[model samples]
Target: MQTSLATSVPSWAVGDVTVHRVDEIPLPPATGPWLLPDATPEVVAGQQWLHPDFADHEGVLRLDSHSFAFVVDGLRVLVDTGIGNGKERANPAWHNLRTDFLERLTAAGFPPESVDLVILTHLHADHVGWNTRNVNGEWVPTFPNSRYLTSRAEREFWAGYDMEEARRQMFRDSVIPVEQAGLLDTIDVPAGGVEIARGLRLIPTPGHTPGHLAVELTSRGGAALITGDCIHHPVQLAHPAVGACVDIDPRQSEATRRELLGSLAGTDTLLLGTHFAPPTAGRVVAHEDAYRLQPVPAA
Candidate 1:
């Protein structure tokens, strides 16, 4: 059985761009404690604000896996494809999913062939799973007509990496198919980041991966930042020191988070968490020494 979109698609207005949060599987409750070990029940309890939305009253965290889709200047763009269906994965939660991801994508008005660009935040398994889909006997590029993009550093790093069999399997099915099809592209995202399309830019948010990126979209005076994997959930906003166990460079990841949060602390820039659960989009506000998200529910 496939999961259906529970409601009409949740969306946000950023100046001229209307971003949509395409539904994917909500991670299991065990995901929170495993992903962020530092965010213990005690720590979660301390933050009285996380309850009802981000965490249970018992202090269990809530996380999700989804993608952001929208059109800007006639280009249908999707940021970070979630864990794909039918892929073999080491994580039980992500293994061989059979959700109606493509159907949901088509319903969002950006069918696979209609997509103009697919921006990869990083090369992580969950983030790049939908890059390809098993077709008959082989994994093939899902978006046949779209140009796939990722930071040059990300690919190069993996090229020289001695990956575990699990990761190698992920690339063979997800990443390599896109590259082999001549659809994958590599861009040099500098410290200041680079603009790929009009009003769309990629900010270098490394440490999760050597060349991880966070997508940014600007229309008129309004702006939005998509946190690829740099910030997994809103809990990170209140506890910047709490790091994901999977971080490649925990120190660098923290620095990037702090700097990124500082820049958007008081501004009206809308922050969209790639793995954030319900009410995913928000405004970053200064709280004590760090920041907290003021959720901007879809309209």
Candidate 2:
């Protein structure tokens, strides 16, 4: 079934902060088993609320790779740079190609040069792809003036991780280049949480990666949470135990999911999913023994 898609650039105001969604690519429908190993079609089909938005009538998941541009206290901050153009990646789908992400960012009123800070929730290939871009012949920081922030644990883990050749190439081309330019800032992972700006902070949500952190925004009386990769899709809200194969620790990821869902359910806090399709921001609601995502009405 086909449904009218949300605007590519959706904006939301959290008290004083303004956020815009910058989409790089709308991924093709994926099978339940492929994206979430334990989620079968029969199981996903039961998630009636996911249809026409997060999933198709046939139970195929609708996912996207995008970034959130946040304007906090007059400071421009971006969360999770999407898979960039012209980068060699371990995933064939992300291999060298061209995208208009920067252009979209510009159109959304966030030119790369204006970004004050670029936060990488984790050092995954997709999350940090746009940290740097291929210039004349050198890899250069995309947001030249922005101070790139990432967790110390994440940088250390990936630095020595024995991964495939392509992933190594990803780090060399996308991550290391930023460090070489003296633009990367490794923050100590917080036990509780640490404030990055006036109303913005990083909440450690490890398990997906050693240092994965979800961004929290609070302004006035409004609150929003950006789930970097801890909760990829709404399906995970229903089956918190169905961990992604890419997660470094599946069990840990599961625990984090349940905790987050339980804490945010029936609250006014807005949940922004990093990979959720259109209408990406929603509110968590309790569903029997698990949870469900109720998309926020478009404004």
Candidate 3:
């Protein structure tokens, strides 16, 4: 079944950079326990700001597997690649997806060939699935001209990772093919973050994955953050201690969430969540002791 939920492409601008959300699939409503084991319905009920968009009245979390495409300084850079088509995923919903992601990407003004850079936030199945496409029983780089960027630490970790059979398959189909195509470039990210382009940098935001990096865009004094699974849902903002089940280090992920959200709270920085549903981009605002996502009004 098709999972692209947005009827139209949602976009926002920060300084000179224009960001567009290209959704590959809309995941079904997941229970809080499935995502954050500590987040029960009672716990989620207290986060009133999550209603309608991030969560339902029943406390089911709304999420999407999508990518944020940034047009920066005449360059097309994609933050993350959503679950691609024709891949065998352990998650049945993600396997063999034949959605109109490419068509929608073109409609959003980003053809695969036109993309100059593809940034994988981390080496996760969902994030890197679209790195390659299956053609004539051969996996090949989808963006032939683009240079794929990922953290050197992340690439090294996955290189030696004793992954489960399913995830190993993901590495083979989605990640290996890109490397084999000679389009992959692993960068040594600095403590202060590495500037991939003028006004755009990859800030290390680990814990979710040991080497996860969030994309920061600053231009003309305006700023926006492409959160690469740092905080999956708005509910997490209200309870930073709650960590995702998939977090490599739950405690560290919680701490990172608090630090990241605390820093952005009360600031004008726009927050674009990688897994957030429609109206995915928002601002972090201080709410009580924690933070909350204030969804930016549709443009």
Candidate 4:
């Protein structure tokens, strides 16, 4: 079922680097609302994720195959790997997906083996699912030779905590395998910049997770930013205080949103959101009191 849908990676050149969206899988009905008790239809309106096409769907928000790709300085890097095969949880929708993320990666021109680095902004199940794949009964790094990058703080916290059962199970299935394979690298990006490649650096944008980081790219004097879960939906643009119910630290998430959005508004910086739909990249604009998304003009 994952292979039947069309995959698109809105591409653009930011100075010298080329970026693409190596999408994994998108849930139909795109949006409505997850099961958050506080979610109000009024608050979710006019959001791209909440397209009118989703009016018939109820109780759950469909997800999209939105992932970021960074091709710079002769290296190909994947910002996040969406939900992969065999991830089991209570949520039937996301339980054990047998996706062809590798095929999707190939469709995007960078086969799994071509990916030099896989950077996970946080340790959520969806983000790390593709870190490894089942190989003849043993789990192995999906991108055989690529280094899997994640935050040290996030790795330690989840590795040694009493988390919700489902999440802990996610760690056991999707994350630990990469560690055991010695393909995981815990990147420390507390400050703003830590070079990952020639022009790519890791920026600390912690909020949703204790060590959440956004990727910053610079080439020929131009810059772009991959905002991982900092702003889940554009509606959050109007109500930055309404952080995701799944966020571990709501107060910190809110503060990160304000600071990240405030700094990127009207700048040359391009913003890429994980759950944001195709044409996932955009610029920020300061609206009435909050903020607004100025999506890249369609090609």
Candidate 5:
């Protein structure tokens, strides 16, 4: 089946609660050097489903996808907004490109204006790109009524340390405007977790950023954890210690990755990685000594 059509199924038996994967963004190069030498480009390219001429750039570009969430509570809710429309983006490949993200969301029964809550894992450009819409030179919250939630640490870090020119653009373009419009909420990351609504909870997973978080949902005695960028590539499952160069604190990121992987593997948890390939939702399987992703079949 085609990659897009492959993920048409939303609800799946993830332990107890039903889970779904709503792809808000898509990337090309199936294999590149995102992790480290351990996850070689050759190995990633060998995957049958991966595209050959993935990204429009040289040096291992990957055709990957971005994930948001749709929780099956009594009410419909959203997790994160993938890279949105119309921006003077940095990366040549991702810049000024048009995507059908909104359409895809609508196709999956989520209209931009209908989203109940948007839980951003972090304030990164890719994660917050679709938080707002361009309305006559002003950036406004797309989900005007929906509360856009983020962690306090993440908000403070980006607000103070966005020194790089590109970063400033991301904040100025995607984040600050949301706050100005009174749609952003900075939540406390307590040990027990912060309840967004009835069943949805913002669970702190930290490390990738000062306040990186994961969303955990419990209903009908079932649960699933939406891992933001804690685990970027599947190869990380093989070597959880290798940190991404984009990580703020490599050591902390590595530690978190190891702990999260270990903890989740011990349970019947449904693991979801934002930058993982299509059908991004899956479960962990003990492989020899470590663990690997065993993606549930597409519904």
Candidate 6:
């Protein structure tokens, strides 16, 4: 977890589907302490497996802000959009800033206009910031040709919930513009999850948000999962009890993490972390009692 943005985009192949990691900004050191308060230095140090790549020898957790891109069934897709270039925000890290995200996307072989679908895992400020971009004097949908998809429960829950000014401002700039353009669509995610295309599915993994989702893709018997915020960092795999401060329901979040990890353990499925540092993709292997990620280097 170097803090610098990579020049070459790293990608992994899941059967016929190739998932690319689109680098955003590497979150500052403070992000670890604030986001996962329970992942203290001592707690992080105990998990020796996280060293060097995921955490420093001193036990500071390494985290990043990025998205996964790939193509499935003739559809050029982007799982989640990272924080946009320039925007007003209460958080110092996410406030008005500039980054070469769009250029990076193009380098990965999927330009904004070429993307057929933009799958939003949830409506978090950072997750959906790129849903729209500042155009001229107003915010507008960045991918006008793309169909933005998310779970129906996700949008409805945020609609009725009391949101702070920061959140409301985020929606005004990043989310509302997409909706007003009539490009946003919601789907009912059943218990078994809903398949959108031949090999793409939306699995409901609520807790972070009532409608939070984890995208799943399969082709030729090979499979991969894009963990939105359900499993934020690799450390969580070792200590499933550790939950993010942003979780709406800590209990449910823990349960969801356990279930997802349990099902993937000892399987060949590749787990691509939305916020994981380099070697962002891995397989969940059963460790002592819980599980640990067996890093899968991108091909």
Put down candidate 4 lDDT per residue, 1-299, tens digits, no spaces: 33342244357678888777766676654232552324456555544444532222242443465577768888889988887888776666677887666776777677888888889989887788887777897767888888889888888877677888888777777788878878889977756568877888888777798888888888887788887877776667767887786788889988988988899888888777777665566788887787777777323
Tell me model 6's lDDT, rounded to 2 decimals.
Answer: 0.91
Candidate 5 per-residue lDDT over residues 148-174, each given as its tens digit: 889998888876783788888878888
- The TM-score values for the models, in the order shown, are 0.97, 0.95, 0.95, 0.88, 0.85, 0.97
lDDT of 1 by residue, 188-237 (tens): 99999898889999999998888999999999999999999999978889
Once fitted onto the true fold, the runs of candidate 2 whose alpha carbons sit more than 4 angstroms away are 1-8
Q: lDDT for every model? A: 0.91, 0.86, 0.86, 0.73, 0.70, 0.91
How far off is residue 221 in model 3, in Å?
1.4
Worst 10 residues of 3 by lDDT: 1-10
How does candidate 4 score on lDDT?
0.73
Clashing pairs in 1: none
As a whole number from 0 to 100, the lDDT of residue 20 in candidate 5 is 57
For candidate 4, give the lDDT of residue 252: 94
Clashes (N, CA, C under 3 Å) per candidate: 0, 0, 0, 0, 12, 0
Misplaced by over 4 Å in model 4 are 1-8, 28-32, 35-39, 46-63, 297-299
lDDT of 2 by residue, 246-289 (tens): 89998889998888899999999999999988899899999968
Instruction: List the lowest-lDDT window of 10 residues for candidate 1.
Output: 1-10
Candidate 1 error regions (>4 Å): 1-7
Q: Point out the higher-scoring one by lDDT: 5 or 6.
A: 6
Candidate 2: clashing residue pairs, number:
0
lDDT of 6 by residue, 1-299 (tens): 12243448889888888899988889988889898999999989988889889999988888999988999999999988988878889989998869888878888887899999999999998899889887788999988899999999999999998999999999999998999999999999987999999999999999988899999999999999999999889999999999999999999999999999999999999999998998888999998889999999876
